[model samples]
Target: MCGIVGYIGKNEIKEILLNGLKELEYRGYDSAGIAVLQDRELSTFKAVGKIINLENKLKDFSTQGFGIGIGHTRWATHGKPTEANAHPHIAEFSNVVHNGIIENYQEIKEMLQAKGHHFLSQTDTEVIVHLFEENLKNCDDSFKAFKKTIDTIKGAYAILLISKKDSTKIFYAKNGSPLIIARGEGGIYFASSDAPLIGLAQEVVYLEDGDIGFMQEGDFDKLQNIQPLNINKSFAQKDGYRYFMEKEIYEQHSVLLETMMGRVSEDRIALENLDRDFFEGIESITICACGTSYHSAMVGKYLLERFAKIRVNVVIASEFRYADFVIKENELFITISQSGETADTLEALKLVKKHHLKTLAICNVDNSSIVRESDRVILTRVGIEKGVASTKAFASQVLVLWMLGVFIAQEKKLINAQEIKEQAQAMLKATKATKVDSKLHERIKRLSKRYLHGHGFFFIGRDVFFPLALEGALKLKEISYLHAEGYASGEMKHGPIALADSHLFTIALMPEHLLFEKIKSNIEELSARDATICVISSQECEVADDMIFIPKASSYMEEFFSMMVALQILALEIAIKLGNDVDMPRNLAKSVTVE
Candidate 1:
């Protein structure tokens, strides 16, 4: 995944492009570059790492009178993260910045070479600009030539193109990847997501598959060039938080409310988008997802079986697509993704479609590929999750799964309306009660400092909390660059406990649930070996060398929400204490669009 931004405005082009790139840096940060049109020539500058490097490089260049530019921050796929492979690839006739993989680049490169076209870098993106240059030979219109270039390529892509001959306009298109165009006070802007458009654009247009459009310098009022989109201005501000992650963490309460808004009442749950008859004859369900979404599915398995009395299987999307797995009759396939364009999950969805099984999608983005392809869809109203490490999105996914369990329970007559309403109210209370104060963060920071130089880490939880343990470990390792492993509390003694000692730190999740004593015993075992134990629990206990206390939840569902928020805060504080980049981690991208 990479971040691409284009600006056509009256402001200083370099500053606008650089600021937009910085805002979109979470998508990718391996390399940064910008291409601007000035003096009827396309000038490019790129650096090997970070947007700051690109900014330093631009100090020697002149950007005066330049009002049109395209920028990119790259997460390398086809080539190494080198300056030569960075984006804003320029050719004789056009300059282009691309996101997504080019599956047929090799074949096209050979044909272009035969036609006497030479290549510079070992990037699939270079093939696109060169192809645009070749298409201009057969067509006079820049838009038609760009379309012709798109016709020859295959795979997911969102490309922004600017012709040297026509420096006043920027042409772009998207297929199977995200690309949004917005109209701002300054001018028209385009980016991979809405984060970069904040404070810059008042209205945004989300491009669908095969959608092609362009923006001229003063064409903010013209809606004839592209499909008009409804603007929701709520997402434009950070609401006074220092970082997006912190804002998102605190927004979980509202996220849960929005996810369940108008859909749950005193006695019933309403998934209005899903047909009433769709749940009929669904004997089993297979949920496929990646990363945070997969962890949510793991928790869903517990909820569905315990409350809904339905058998469930959770599979990693990448492995499920390649493995020789069987889909039995009357089985339902569901996929969960925040972006709804994750390559492995989307590929698995395509494969599931071939079997003619009923499919459902739990996605945050409306009209995403997964949402459009599924027979039934549940949209999580979490808004745009800008942080690379997901916080609010995961909480919303769990809330939706809880609603689904209650819905299925009501459908089977296993639970009454009063019981359902009580459950909903409990959840609402839990969301409001889960808060991370400055004092808690200070304590977590102290714990993080003490364990900062440890060799590795172990996160242990039992029952539904097991998936949370995995998710907690993932967050710590993702942002802090620490080596960590998560294991079921019971399974810790089987193998992982041997790795635990004074040199390794253990963070245990001890919720006040059915398995509380069992997990506490696991913590005790680790303590016996002189392991430093940091316990996240509803109450303080003797076994915990350090305790991070959460509000005692009334139900296991509430406990799940509270414990999740606690662990997220722990991870964030740990990363911040270590001086790591919490928003954009090394060697990772926000959306994994390429396999």
Candidate 2:
């Protein structure tokens, strides 16, 4: 998961490249660099951590040229986050910025070293520029040399190559990694994702695997009718909020509407991309995803099994990649990813595609890798989630999955019209119920500090709420850098309750409509041991040390939507109390585009 941005135009290159990289900073921020070609000379600047460091290095640097440049923000796959290992790796002939793994780099490095070539850094990416440099000796054209270098490499990569020999063009190639070319105001721009291209470019092309091409100085303006990227510049701003995470956390109300607009209604969930009979006779479903998406899949498993009356399996995409799945005769494969370019999930999608299974993707980005690879798709219109910790995307994913499950149940005649109508009304109510207001925010902010002193936090629930517990604990751990665990409330006495004490915080999700008493006794069990309990529920739990009561939801689905938003706010407040970067948490990128 690295950010790669390049430009070739008449505008000033540094600011354009830097701004594009800033949009893609959620992809990575371990280290960053840029290689800008000016007046027939290539200049390279490197920084050890964060794009800001690179920006500082280029503060006083001056340049005069046609504005051809390539920049990188690294998530460091092959080497440590060091200046020596940063991207825009330069050799004698060509400089390169690459994403994805070079699986056969050691062997290739040895081959190149034997030919009297020397290496500079402990990175697999260094091999690409050096290989291109070596290939230039055999080919008259730099683009041909770049192609030969790509042909020789055996791994995943979205590569941008430039050379001192040809400052008028920016050559690119993609294989098993994300790379898109956007025709914008000045010229053609390249970014690993749509985040950078949006607002900057109107038309864009998502380059496919095995695609190789170059944008020459005089050639990009001819074809002007390509599909325009759905650009919303507001997604990149925090408005008056302190951080994007906070803005997104409060955006759930409108986000629910955005996700349901045109696609979800009272009588139907319009996923017409899948054939009418697609869900017919589907004995089971396999949902593959990672991180927050994986947690959403867990919730989906509960919904799909409860509503659709089908066996549902939620597999972590990273593990699913290597596992030998038991694919059934009438099984459906669904994958979830906000970026749709998550490397493990995309690889898993490709892996299952080999078995000829019908695939559906629930994603936010329109043309992400997962969306392109799937047989059918559902777009979660939560807008661009700039926060690396993921606020609105998770809410939208879970909501979309719920709608899909209920729709399938109706389509299969598993639920009657009365039941379907009730489900739809409950969803409509959820859009209003799942709102977080100033009262709850203030309440959460007031108590957010009490949680910071805990040794660890336990987010406990039962049945479907078990996954919400996991997600709650994950959010706390991700943003606050605190130790937290999510466990079934029933399993407290099994062994974990021994760790419960005043120093321990338990954020119990005890919904009034769903197993409230069952989870209440579990909370009481933890209370007996003097665990600091922050109860988030619609019921008054006398055993809780603190409470953030939500509006009583009408149904199980509504309960989840409301409680889910509450948990997200709780985590955001807690992280803010600890003075953590709420938007970009440490060592965590927004999109896990690499394993």
Candidate 3:
């Protein structure tokens, strides 16, 4: 994934483009570049590293009166991360910035080479501008040439093109990848997502697949070509936090409230898309997801099985669609995804639908493909999660799954109305009790320094916490770039224990539950093997080198929420201490739209 930003406005184009790139840095950070139109000439600047490198490089260029510009932060899918491969690939007539892969770029490159078009960089994006130049030669009109260029290419892409022949306008198009256009007071703005246009515009128009349009200076309002989008713009700001992830980590309390708002009461749970009669006849449940969403599905398996007395299986979406698995008539398939557009998960859903099996989706985006394909859907109201590493969406997914379990248990008569009411109240109390102390962050910061250079890390937990342990390991590995593994406490002795040594740091989730003593013994075994231990629990343990004590909640579910919040904070602090990019980890993109 790459980030794209374009501006056609009266304000300083360079500054606006740079700030927009900074807002979208979380989407990509491999390399950055910008192309500005001034004096009827297209000027391009590119750097091989982060956006800051491009900003420094721009200092030498004078772009004071440039009224139109386009910028990109690339993730380097087609070529290596180098200045020559950075975006804003320029041809004689046009400069282009693109996001997504060009599946037919090799063929197009060969065709262009036969036409005597020379290439300078090894990137599929470079083919786009040159193709546009070739099409313009055959067709005098710029719009017709743009259409011909896109028609010649085959792949998912969101592209922004600026031509030297038309310096006053910016042409853009999208196929599979996301692209948004917004009109602010001074000008028109384009980005890959809404993160860059948060404060810049209250309303925006989302370009659907295969949509193409252009924006001219001083023509901010005439966008009848594209439809306006209906988005909830309530929580777009950082709310005083330095990073969106940090703000989202602390917003878990509010996230829980919003997740449960009006949908759950003392005795009843309302899932808008679910049919209670259908749920009663369901025999088994299968969940498919990937990454953090997969971890949430693992926890969902525990909740659904333990509470509803149903057999549940959790599968990684990427593997599930390929595996030789039969979909029974009584089995219900569920997919969990934050974006709801995860390629593997959506493919899994399609396979389930092909078998005529009933499907449900637990997702964040309302109009994503998974939601559209599912027979039923439950939306996770965590708002727009801008950070690449998810925070609030995970909590919201867990809460929604927990509520679903409660609903199923009530339907099965395993839990009475009064018990359901008590559980709901307990969840509400736990949401109120969840807190992240400043001192805890400071303490974790200190502990992180000792393990910054460790060979690797191991995270262990039992029952529902086992999935959380996996999530914790994922967070640490994703942003901090540390090698980490998660295991069930009992499974540690099977194989992972062989890797235990003083160079290895282990984080244990030992909540004061039924499996607490068993996990304690497991932690002792790791400690005896000379591994440093960090425990997240309600009570302090003598075996742990450092203990992160969370507030005791009324029930195991509440405690699980609190523990997850603490682990999120711990991971964030560790990433900060390591000087790693917490918002945008290297080699990882915010969304996995392609397989």
Q: Output the number of the TM-score-best candidate.
A: 2
lDDT, candidate 3, 1-595, per-residue tens: 5788999866787888899888776565688899988778778889887778888888877655547899998887877999899989998868999987888999999999999999989999899999999988888789888889998899878899999878888999987677788887767889887767867775577776788877786555676444444555556667888778998888878877888898888878777767578685789999999999999999999989988889999999999988898778999999999987677788789888989888999998776667878988999888788789988888889888888888888877899888888978977976765556677667776766777877999989999999999999999999898899889999988999999999999999988864889999999999999999998888888999888887775577777877887788878888898788787788887777666
For each candidate in the order shown, give its overall lDDT on alpha carbons.
0.84, 0.86, 0.84
Whole-structure CA lDDT of model 1: 0.84
Among all candidates shown, the one with the greatest lDDT: 2
1 or 2, greater by lDDT: 2
User: Between which residue pairs do clashes occur in model 3?
Assistant: none
Residue-level lDDT tens digits of model 1 in 244-290: 78788888887778888888777678887764478889999999999
**Which pairs of residues collide in model 1?**
none
Error of 1 at 324 (Å): 2.5
Query: Model 3: runs farther than 4 Å from truth?
Result: 60-67, 166-168, 213-243, 273-284, 321-333, 346-359, 366-376, 409-414, 540-542
| TM-score per model over all chains | 0.92, 0.97, 0.89
Candidate 2 lDDT score relative to the true structure: 0.86
- Error of model 3, residue 526, in angstroms: 2.3
How much is the lDDT of residue 17 in candidate 3? 89
Clashing pairs in 2: none
The stretch of ten residues in a row with the least summed lDDT in candidate 1 is 224-233
